[model samples]
Target: MKIYPIETGNFKLDGGAMFGVVPKSIWQKTNPADANNLIEMSMRSLLIEDGNRLTLIDTGLGNKQSDKFFGYYHLFGDKTLDSSLAKLGFCKDDITDVFLTHLHFDHCGGSIEFNKDKTAYQPAFKNAKFWSNKEHWLWATEPNAREKASFLKENIIPIKESGQLEFINLSEDNYIKNSELNFDILCVDGHTEKQMIPHLNYKGKTLVFMADLLPTIGHIPLPYVMSYDTRPLLTLNEKQSFLNLAADKNYFLFLEHDAHNEICTVKHTEKGVRLDKTYTFNEIFN
Candidate 1:
């Protein structure tokens, strides 16, 4: 099995929101903010190539929003889904499965696109089945007031409309596994309802796709949870549990929103699970 990093683009988000109750003086050191106090973030996705199934984990922020709507996020960079796919000699139609970590705009927005007439929305991956867990599907569709803005209908409804939406039946341990795919699902509820993090067993290493659970290296500390998380206390416990397991298992964390660092590992330090080493995708995978 081969995994490719698909970089959709970069955008800026309020540093405070990304770092939760953590002080700017601390987080800014790792994810330095611009003059506007917004930190650069990458809408990074992963493409898993195994046999005939090309599963894509998390679609980045698509380009269907209005200029004013996008202006708020400060979208920048030349990398896009199409361009990145082209670089890999693939296209939207090549994707067989779109495994969404959750239905947040940035994580699933690219799953749909506007039709040629701009009058209808359609699934971006025409030949792909959109995968989302039942709990997250409901949480996003019937969003609470605090998370309503992030769960955009345009990013989600079309997948079901396309007759391609499927939910994973997680086991009692909140795990899902398919024989064809060389990975298992680790579902957690802190970030959102049942956000599924992929634990890929590739080349003798367990590479975890860190969706919003651990956005960047800056969030390695247990206290550094995101303010956008619906249950911050739950997130604290979730992160602690996941970090301890990751450190013990020596998992390679593939970061989603970290623009500077692509991947990192953790060590059981005196303080707790601390950042071990950072590397590009190719640095280790190649």
Candidate 2:
């Protein structure tokens, strides 16, 4: 099996929102912020190739939003879903599954695009089935006012309209559906409902999609949680438990937002699970 890092470009988010209760004085040193106090974050996605399955995890923010909306996030960079896939000698049409960690704009916005007629929305991966847990699907579709702004209808409704939306719930016996890949799902909340992070058994090593749960090595500290979390205390507990297991088991956590660092491991320091080392995805997989 082969996995490619799909970079959908970078966008700016308030450092405070990203770092949560962590003091700006500290987080700023690790993830330096701009004059606007916004940190540059990667809309990094992953493409998994196992047997005949080509699954793309979490489409990044697509270019369908209005310029005014784009003004807020300040999306910048030459990297995109198409270009990144091309770098791996593939294209969107080749994708057979889109495994969304959640439907947040930055994570799954690129799942759909505007039609040429400028009046309709269409699934970005025409041939791929869009994956989201049933509970999270309801949470996003019938979202609360607090999350409504982030859950745009255009990025979502089209997936259902395409007749490719599939829901994976706790009742599922096999997470991957196919026996081709030996990977499992680790579903968690606080960040969002039932966001599924992929855990893969690759070359005697376990690689996990850290999907906002750990986000970056900088977020290893439990209190370094993001303010965007629906439940900050719940996040603290989740991070504490996950990081401890990761440190003990020597698991590699893949960052979905860090602009520079891709994968990192944790170590049990006096202060608990702190950053141990950072490595590129290719370095680990190859």
Candidate 3:
């Protein structure tokens, strides 16, 4: 199987919000903020080419939102989903499956797009089946007040409306071994309800899609949970367990939102798990 990193775009988010209660004095050292206190972030996605199935994990924020809507996030960058795919000699129609880690706009907004003449919303990946779990589907669709802003109807409803949405069967422990997508899925509830993290064994190494569970290298510490997380205490436990397992097994973490660092690995440090090293996608994947 061949995997490629898809750069959809870049945007800025409040560093305080990204790092939660972690003081700016600490997080700013790693994720330095701009004058506006916003930190630049990447809307990076992953594309896996296995046999005839080209599965894309997360689609990034699409360009359908209004300028006023996008101004809040301060979107920037020349790389787009189409351009990235084109560089790989592919296009939207080439994708067979779209595995969404969650329904947040930055992660799954590119799933749908405005149709021709902008009359209607439609699935962006015309030939691909959108993948999400039943639990998350409900959580996003019927979002709570805190997360309502992040789960936009324009970015979500179209997938189900298009009749191309599919749910992955999750086990009781929230672990799926050898899923139909050709990887293991670890579903955690801390970062939203049932956010699925994909674990892929590729090139003799285990590569995990960090998603929001570990947004950036700055978030390696167990206490550095995002404020957006509904259950911060649950996130603490989940990160503790996952980080320990990751350090022990030496997993290569594929970061989706880290604009500067593409992949990272953690090791057991005296201060608990810490960033061992960082790699650009090419440094290891190539």
Best by TM-score: 3
TM-score comparison, 2 vs 3, better candidate: 3
Q: Rate residue 88 of model 1 by lDDT.
A: 97
Give the TM-score of each candidate.
Answer: 0.98, 0.95, 0.99
lDDT for model 1, please.
0.92
lDDT of 2 by residue, 135-247 (tens): 89999999988889889999988899889998765545324432223467877788887778788777889888888787767788888988888988988887887789999
Q: Of the pair 2 and 3, which is ahead by lDDT? A: 3
For model 3, how does the per-residue alpha-carbon lDDT over 58-167 read when each residue is reduced to its tens digit? 99999999999899999887999999999999999999999999999999889999989999999999999999999999999999999999999998898998999999
Identify the runs in model 3 with alpha carbons over 4 angstroms from their true place.
Answer: none
Tens-digit lDDT track of model 1 for 1-286 = 8999999999999999999889999999999999988999999999999889999999899989999999999988899999999999999999999999999999999999999999999999999988887888999999999999999998988898889998888777887785224578888998888998999988889999999999999999999999999999999999999999999999999999999999999999889999999999999999
**Model 1 spans with C-alpha error above 4 angstroms:** 179-182
Per-residue error for 224 in candidate 2, Å, reads 0.7
Kindly provide the TM-score of model 3 when superposed on the true structure, using C-alpha atoms.
0.99
